[model samples]
Target: MADIESEQAAAAAGSGALVLFSGGQDSSTCLAWALERFGTVETLGFDYGQRHRVELECRDALRQGLTDLNAGWAARLGPDHTVNLAALGEISNTALTRDVAIAMSEGGLPNTFVPGRNLIFLTFAATLAYRRGLKHIVAGMCETDYSGYPDCRDDTIKALQVALNLGMDRRFVLHTPLMWIDKAETWALTARLGGEPLVALIREQSHSCYLGDRSHHHEWGFGCGTCPACQLRAEGYRRFVAAAV
Candidate 1:
């Protein structure tokens, strides 16, 4: 394939975008989408000392795939910048970073909700983009099918965008690709943007399981199927598969 879509995206964007990539299903899809839509895409990751660090391990392969898809990416793409936020581990007591149990209490947010994660992440991405003179930041945050994270809401992101712009005195637009769609629609979008091959690649390679155990595989990545992340991903994959059939 010519990867014409990526070229068109680059032209349309007129420059590059900074993507908050986590090497998970959502962020990987966003990375591929950004490469296809923006002139170039810079990937930024965080190492907040999550117990399941396999997510970060996948970043390199995903970035390499972008180059394979479009030779131009070898130049246009920015090196993956992963920051170590070990301090976050010291401050938060979530299931992601701690040995604590993942639980949801009667409509309340789950124990997996890392406090202020997206806010801090996007802020870091914006600061990095500002330094590089790029004005667009891409996040794969979704309101639907979200894991009850307050920070993932549209209002929170929009508010942060304004705050970052005001704080930095620069115009920055945060783009959320999977904001309104649920997990099933996310799969549909991956198929649309990168075709069946990309979809398959994500299914087999991307890591979304909170448990971080790639040892046991499922149709929807390497999730344990008991955790919230696994449950949601599996359900979404089921919906997408049924619809395809």
Candidate 2:
């Protein structure tokens, strides 16, 4: 398999894109989608000193898969561009950071919610794109199923786009392929872009669990299957698989 950098490099040929990849199902799917669409894709993964290093491991695996998918593409994609932006770490109190109890709060931000994560990530991605002279940055943020997150909202992304363009003195396109799609639709999209084998690889290899539990059933990826993310993923998978049959 191609490494993240390699796969992205394959995608990054003449028409390039920068993707905010997290080695999770949604982001992996987006990565694959970027490869198919842009031909030249660059990946940016952040290391905020999360307690779980498995995310990075999976990221590496995804990158490798990308490389294996198209070695020539990987070669063209260029090196993996990753950053250890732990500055955003201190601002987040989510379970993704500290050892505090992980629970989904009611009617407000969930404990799994990291403060300004997407904003920070997209900002970094945009900055990198600006430096590389690429104007397109892709993320997998969803509004249909995850409308609770303020950052994932379409208004928020559009605002951020405006801010980034103004701040950088350049225009950039923020691509959110999954923004309007629910999980089931997202799965269908992945299957369409990457094939059934790739979608299966995503379902089995990607990590979506906030708890970092790797023993969950096959329905969801790694992590406790009872969490909101896992439940939603499982539901989406069920819907997709049933529909396919």
Candidate 3:
């Protein structure tokens, strides 16, 4: 099984990949993962009017930081693309898109759950990849240690991969490297990928706070330190640090 996976990874390394980068820790880690493997790597972000829209602002700096970490990454990194997905926000009544408090919805999910967000994102990513002639669409969607967003499940991604290929008549591989890994593992992966420098870059530049609060800096990063995103990141960083010690 390991040999087969290695062969698959080697085959994928020869192709170009489009990373769905949101300028958050997981997406940033996934971006580094793509840059290290794919022959060419491009980034695509969505401006969905998220309350944490500040994350979008972190994209360029993170990209530059990644490029600075390695000459090869700089050479392999391609153009960045941002699509205006403001319509998603208009339709979403969740806390992430509105001024509402973060709470559990009556549907047994968090109010931050943007319905069909990832599905729409993947569909649009597939469209962009098709136009860009890219063969791989990389995302940071993960099930482990997430906020119960159904769209982040591995099965959802796998099903969407089939739908996209069938609908587009193209062989587009959707890569979610963080699917099975927890947030602590994600931070550890970044350290392994580019060492402490990459880890520091992610901690400082990436924005994952639901409230868009960059005013307060935590050891993990800049956030409100209470939102689900921030809490998860902080706890993960604590674990990462403790494990390192």
Give the winner by TM-score.
3
Name the top lDDT candidate.
3
Flag the better candidate by TM-score, 1 or 3: 3
Model 2 lDDT, full chain set? 0.80
Name the weakest run of 10 consecutive residues (lDDT summed) in model 3: 6-15
**Lowest summed lDDT window (length 10), candidate 1:** 66-75
Model 3, runs deviating above 4 Å = 1-10
Please rank every candidate by TM-score, starting with the best.
3, 1, 2
Model 3 accuracy (lDDT, Cα) = 0.95
TM values, all candidates: 0.92, 0.87, 0.96
- Give every collision pair in model 1: 9-37, 10-38, 10-39
Instruction: Give the candidates in order of lDDT, highest first.
Output: 3, 1, 2
Q: How many steric clashes between backbone atoms does each model show?
A: 3, 23, 0
Q: Go through the candidates in order and give each one's C-alpha lDDT.
A: 0.86, 0.80, 0.95
TM-score winner between 2 and 3, please give it.
3
Q: Pull out the clashing pairs in model 3.
A: none
Q: What TM-score, to 2 decimals, does candidate 1 have? A: 0.92
